[model samples]
Target chain A: MAKIKNLAELRKMREEQQKQLNLREKSNDPEKYVQIKVGMATSGIASGAKRIMDFLIVELDKRGIEAVVTQTGDMGYCYAEPTIEVTRPGEEPIVFGYVDTQRADEIIEKYIKNGELVEGIIPVNYESID
Target chain B: MAQQLKMQLLVCGGTGCRASESESIEAALARELKAHGLENEAKVITTGCFGFCEKGPIVKVHPDNTFYTQVTPADAREIVEEHVLKGRKVERLLYTDPENKEHVPDSRHMGFYRKQIRIALRNCGFINPENIDEYLARDGYEALGKCLAEMTPDAVIDIMKKSGLRGRGGGGFPTGLKWEITRKSVADQKYVVCNADEGDPGAFMDRSILEGDPHAILEAMAICGYAIGATKGLIYIRAEYPLAIKRLKIAIDQAMEYGLLGKNIFETGFDFDVELRYGAGAFVCGEETALIHSMEGSRGEPTFKPPFPSVEGYMGKPTNVNNVETFANVPIIINKGADWFASIGTERSKGTKVFALAGKINNVGLIEVPMGTTLREVIFEIGGGIKDGKEFKAVQTGGPSGGCLTQKHLDIPIEYETLVEAGSMMGSGGMIVMDEDDCMVSMAKFYLEFTVEESCGKCSPCRIGNKRLHEMLETVTEGKATMETLEKLKNLSNVIKDTSLCGLGQTAPNPVLSTLNNFWDEYLEHVEDHKCRAGACKSLMRYVIIPDNCVGCTACARNCPVNCISGERKQVHEIDQSTCIKCGTCMEKCKFNAIEIV
Candidate 1:
């Protein structure tokens, strides 16, 4: 809780923090987790994709959904931005598009929670080198 | 069980595409779908910029990925009827390769995108940046979590140092060195600042990223804080970027609620958070020192830097500042290891640089290419050559601060060192391609005018020097400047560049000097003959009608504002050279193949 007064103390603190960071990385299960991918290509952002991605995270947490979230460079379907791909343990990834905060919330409740496909489910329009 | 059916139309909504009225096309598509009773089956969704901006207003039909280009509002009904209802691809709207005239089915087949390796621009058009979980799913903060748990603050800094990532924010400062300096400097508080003040003309790379992938910046800054032992970050974005700022605010709020930003991020006890500070549209604030001063509620002016921001910045504390593009690259470098990044770019410039490829080029949008990519490839191959088949005169990299490079420098690799060697600096990646139609003298004058307006006036050299330089350019354009005036202009430019307090003032003369060196003949013609070679200087140009080609319907006379043309209806119009104001309205209005600029 004290302020670091010198370089030596700061160096010591940094080392101690690194040890803690190492432990966290070691414990993460990369394969067992569900992944959500958001498209962030230039076209995607212009279409308000950032807002949709933010909404999904907050709504998912409120509903106690356990998933790993991340952003990918343009998925080439810039036209279908604010695009989201939801992947569960045994299910094929379901990609949705043109998602807003409201649609994102509905997706969490109907599709993510109750296993129902709601509106705005954008089928992968184009084949990319996934 | 009822079969669930749904269709989505994703439209290219980037600025380049929008300029061609992509929004109108989107609206039309939605309206047609509804009219056809397929509104329930189809939903029109707007998304971020797909990088292939040349063939834009791009429409992709979902589930099948039928890529359509140049879709106007008129074609929206057919798209809804044929593509949505009949399930047939719209063959005419497909992008045909210029060389082979082959209809490219998908983005993968396009030559423009085949060579690109997107990192910083990774998430731009892909996901909703507002959604925190979507960002989480893409392994966004896994690097942050990984850094918090496994890596020491020193280790994180070490990895960044080894990554060979230089600042994309024009200065090319080593990212690792900056962090080390800030981390070493002892202060009651340290800060991480993301300079989103992208003021370079024709540059929108940072704006697109902030709009599409706000979280990437957030995640990168958090990682930066954890590495440098800083707990607070500030994003100094321009107020002009309304959409980018809105998304950034949303991303920040979402990160905080999900425990990604505030104390104990991923339970690591690293209390770091970010806040946004809007810049008042000052170009100087793009500089780190000026940016820090602006954040501290002071005038956005550059100061002498012996104690760099790394030693004492914003509110006089140790601070690390990186631009939007710089921070966008961090998460990848940390996640993929330093060697992976170092291997991608040239030996010295080790990463992809994003450019707002504008002016004369066919593809006027954001493009990210490797450091060693040639100017020729970017201008001709990727940009689809010059617009209207105009001859490539020169390409101006680094905005007003950078020099104009001609065809001789076309094949030179676009690295920072090579650009500098070519008499230009690889500034914040604004590559404005100029064609033969562009008057170099006038171009220089245009840029000088902009610099004159933007100078903060704190320093004498920039304020006074730029005003005088602008006046000289105006004189040259008006055919009133003498050879003596030209010499004075050159001398003043050198003094301003050498003595100016900040980057804004220092580089104000780049446009003038570069044009003078490359297009000295044009200037000579202007002074000696009082003629604008490109016919761009209105005062030096006159509109004349050729007798043979003119079947005069009085079109020119009717359109002339100053009554410069004295001719009856159905007679060849005679333009009175003495009375002519040289507005060129007569030339544009004349339907006959008669009007010529002399």
Candidate 2:
């Protein structure tokens, strides 16, 4: 937490910071861990994304799943509330829609834990905003 | 440790969403979480504008990425109980895609976000603007650090020039050139000015940027200070933007604490600092000279531009001024090479421009797209088309300064040069989409009315010419305008453009001229037929009782505030045209759909 004195120090700090922001996974290698991105736009949040988020993090830790969860800006599917794009190790990110606490736990148990898909899978038809 | 572990619930606390009770939504969420004893496991936080104001009061659940739209405070308990406790997604609250009628569970799949590439607005809805750590975690200050330690003033300016980032503040002047001019200006004291005074009628992009990502502006300003050899930076934001001003103050203080701004920043011995100056929200103060004058405690009036603000600004010192969005683009441009930035937009205008997408559009919010993205894409793909399936008639870009572009110009790539060449300059990106219902004459009058009121009156052409333009528009909408008045309006607008002292006067007649060019037939219909086809101008429209539809139930007569409807009960009724108020109350009250407008 010291003040960055030079460019080298700043770069080092950025490296550490980048690891923390590893939730975003700029490398795009899904094999590292289970990656989950919560649609955090106004629409998603208004439809109870908060509740779903709390459920996912708590249940994941309790269930002992090695998943890195992060908040991302809107991907434009506002009609779908409590949506999450889940990427298992060495798998394509499959987005699930209308995720409640029950769905969140089911996804962590079946999808993240057992590598099985669940209901409310939002079909991906467009490229994500990189 | 507990704070970061638990799921983070981000509620939009932007001005628009906050007005729609997002604060109460946040508080309701917090209360509901505690009631269920999940408060410790769930953290409810208020972030900045989510840009999608139409579907505001957004609640985003982290890790799962559940995007909830149009959430009410009443839905808080159900959210906590069903979604939080029972792990069940709320069915009714989910946003139903207009196209497929499918419940879209993710924001990434929405039509509104398909084409948008968020750079200037990257952090808007994602991060809490008040938090310094959040900003730092997003690679915020690294640009400033790199600029100071790695690149010289000339080198930094060269990158900016190569990036081809023109000013997002309407004029489309090159940002690098502006900085170089300031760098070359021999001055005892130099300054970096951030123009946060966004005065366009429908535009809120700048305000949202400040509220959503205040640190972006600060970091960019610090870099500008280093690039232009300035020690002091000033953000001249309007006083009307209370939320933006509040967020900016927090960001500046946090930057100072983190050694990002002020003395010895990034250990590079760069003694740059940012200060906030509040404007009274004068529309003319958006002009650089007027903004500088307003900052220096003078009347917000723009003088001649032989010596632009770069040469002499802010108490007659060399100052470099960049609009909020322009600065927001600076950091990423430096981080991701000039080529990376330049490759996104058109040949002339590189990087993206943030637009406050408003008016009759389905997705009324803020958006950032690459410069060449056509108006059609913005209106349909990103905007989710016009609201209520209304046919798009025209779109007014750049507020009063820009022109009205019709269906023909939809495919034209929206660059600064293209917009200006098509008779509309890309003024501070405010795209107000008009529908079939919107009267062109009335729309023109509305803009001219704004200009006439906001003109500083320092120049006679703007003062008198804009007023005359407004009057002619008024006459047209009233169906009393002669052909001579139209000719007079056009000639007067040209004269105003030529003789104006500043940008305010120079572009004041754009709406009138643009509307006249794009919607000439609509104007002629008003002047010749004495009718408004769109039924927008109340004066040119008349309320009538359809004889075939009228049941003579006396509903129309009873409901008419002016008692214009006459005829016996259960018989064919007629609306007394002369006495009718055109309030449409009778039409609304009539269950039989009896009333019609002629």
Local accuracy by lDDT, each model: 0.80, 0.84
TM-score of 1: 0.77
User: What total of clashing residue pairs does each candidate reach?
Assistant: 65, 38
lDDT of 1 at B418: 89
Task: Please write out the lDDT profile of model 1 over residues B1-598, one tens digit for every residue.
Answer: 1111235677866666778898899899999987987675567766667766766778865544457888898999988776665445677998888889888865656767666778889866555566655465566676787788789999999999999899998879999999998899998899999999998888888988887789999989999998887999999999988878888898888878767788777666788999999999888889889899898899988899878999989899889999899999999898899999999889999989998888998877678898899998888888889999889999988998999999999999888898888888899989899898888899998888888888889999999999999999999998998999889888999999999998999999998998888888999888888988777888898778999888868888888889889877777779998899888798788777799988
Docking class of 1: incorrect
Tens-digit per-residue lDDT, B471-509, candidate 2 = 888888887899998898899999999999998888888
What value does the lDDT take at residue B487 in candidate 1? 91
| Residue-wise C-alpha lDDT for candidate 2, range A5-85, written one tens digit per residue | 766776666666553343333322335777787886668878888667657766775676767766665766778887988
- TM-score, candidate number 2: 0.84
- Model 1 segments more than 4 A misplaced: A1-130, B1-9, B13-46, B61-65, B72-87, B543-579, B584-596
Quote the TM-score that chain A achieves in each candidate: 0.69, 0.73
iRMSD in angstroms, per model: 16.1, 7.5
